[model samples]
Target: MSGAAIALEGVARTFPGGAQAVRPCALVVPQGEILGLLGPSGCGKTTLLRLIAGLERPDPGGRVLFDGRDVTRLPVEARHVGMVFQSYALFPNMTVAGNVGYGLRVRGVRRAEIAARVEEVLALCDASALASRRVDQLSGGQRQRVALARAVAVRPRVLLLDEPLSALDAALRERLRDELATLLRRFAITAVFVTHDQAEALAIADRVAVMRAGRIVQADTPRALYAAPADAWVARFVGGAADLGGVVSDGSLLLPGGRLPAPGPHAPRARFLVRPGGLDLADRSEATLVGAVTRATFLGDRLRVEIDGAAEGALVVDAAPDAAAAPGARVGLRLRPGGLIVVPEAEEAP
Candidate 1:
């Protein structure tokens, strides 16, 4: 089955006690596009995903449409959407093949057809060898593949996954992030996933929607979102290491620490974000910002240098692995051409 574009028009969810878990918002997911709902805890990303899956209903006047056809009132089963929960939720006693075919069986598919579909999905997920093995006998990675196979075995119109990789250890999760992205593209199915990890969201999804306090603050491609964040919080949350704010005059930000050649619209006062790799340690005579190195750690390929008295608190910068950086050493830093990002003033800036 082909993918369907999804639309949420003024969709919001309010719990019984009048707590608005999700504020009214409109978002569109293009056909076959993988959209990531990204935010911190209690940002309503999970609730929004539930509304799209038909697992939760929206408040009155909200609408959920698949390819412009309304499906707001339909339950999950009728909506023909597949879900993979954070737990993997596989039946411990069931074999891989059995688990993958469970959805087909629920829909009264014939035994022969169910077996054929299960085999196809298991191969797609690279778990064909585990077909006869019980889910409980599989490793964490194996379990995840089986869960994904089960969800896609029936070829649902849309696939919803809630933290599908959160169960794995750090190394395993990093290894599987790319695999999941490849699998989604191969499936070519409309999919929406919930994730709080920014790196995962950027690497896996075609676009990311950043949520805050039950509202969708911004939605854009990973590159656009990083290069041009809508505000200070988004900048800090994405990739920025420090926030520096002061009056900008003649293309320079006059901070207490020093002057930074920040190019942005002239404002009486402005704030700039220094992304971690955006600052380079330079000679004292040519440096724009100066500080004392508080801590330095060699991060395999490069050196992570944390400096104090730069802007406010510690500002981290990426230096060459062999660079001379040690605690208590004074250092001068120069901003790269695209190093600083100018953002609108907000209380979130520190």
Candidate 2:
């Protein structure tokens, strides 16, 4: 499927009650690239996706363009954008092939053409073997595949997905998330997806536009967004980064665990964020700080330890899976230099 570039210029949305759902924003989505609209609930990510899909119009003076063609006033059908809802929204009574070909059939496409397109889409979505299965008999992942196949059957200019993987169980969601990314790449379709799942957005999107309180705070590649969030809130929300609560004085942080060099020039009380993996288990002699282990979970890959007395709140640290640190145990923390995320000191918010 060919992709279309999307541009939003000063786009804003207000409901009947004058509730500002989305603030004025400008964004550009390159052709064939996947952009993730990521934020918590009521953050306007969904509304933003709806505006792009033509389900909601931007307030006056706001313009939406597709490939430089004005499309702000176009209806949903006229825009030719595909959508995959959280529910999958498959027709339970119909067979997988029927659901996949429904849009083409309604558009007066010939039976042969519909069959050809259905077969092609089925193969692309890895649902070919289940072509004859009824939608009701399919699993959550299977239904998702059918929904994707149906969405792409008509060859849309852009594909919009709203929490596409939220319905499945944790394991299935993880597996299908990878499959979805691969499928989109194989189909070569431009896509904009809404997800509160940070890992999902980071793993799949070419770039992520992080929204907060109806405004876009930052938009960048996953690595950049995680490594260098625009603010403390963004840093916490994107990758579960925790604030290394301390007072900066004499070019170092006076953390309860120990003093560490805060390299940049700043006020005596500048704040910072660090990833869970950034801090390591250490001995008192080499420790950046010391804390009591409040909780510990050992997965095959790593041991996730939550510690107290390290910062103002619980600080999660990811250590080697084989490392043993049970709850109620004391652990030393070693902070890595590269893991420190520095933010501007002036704009302070809890």
Q: State each model's CA lDDT, in order.
A: 0.89, 0.89
Task: Give lDDT: candidate 1, residue 223.
Answer: 94
Error of 2 at 187 (Å): 0.9
Worst 10 residues of 1 by lDDT: 262-271
Model 2 agreement with the true structure over 1-350: per-residue lDDT tens digits: 46899999999999999988899999999999899999999999999999999999999999999999999999988998989988988987789999999989888999999999999999999889999998889999998999999999999999999999999999999998999999888989899999999999999999999998888889999999988888888888988899887877777777776766677677444568788987889886777688999899987799999999887778888999988798998888887768778775546321
TM-score of each: 0.95, 0.92
Which RMSD does model 2 reach against the true structure? 2.2
After best superposition, candidate 2 residue 109: deviation in angstroms? 2.4
- Leading candidate by TM-score: 1
Where does model 1 exceed 4 Å of error? 267-269, 346-350
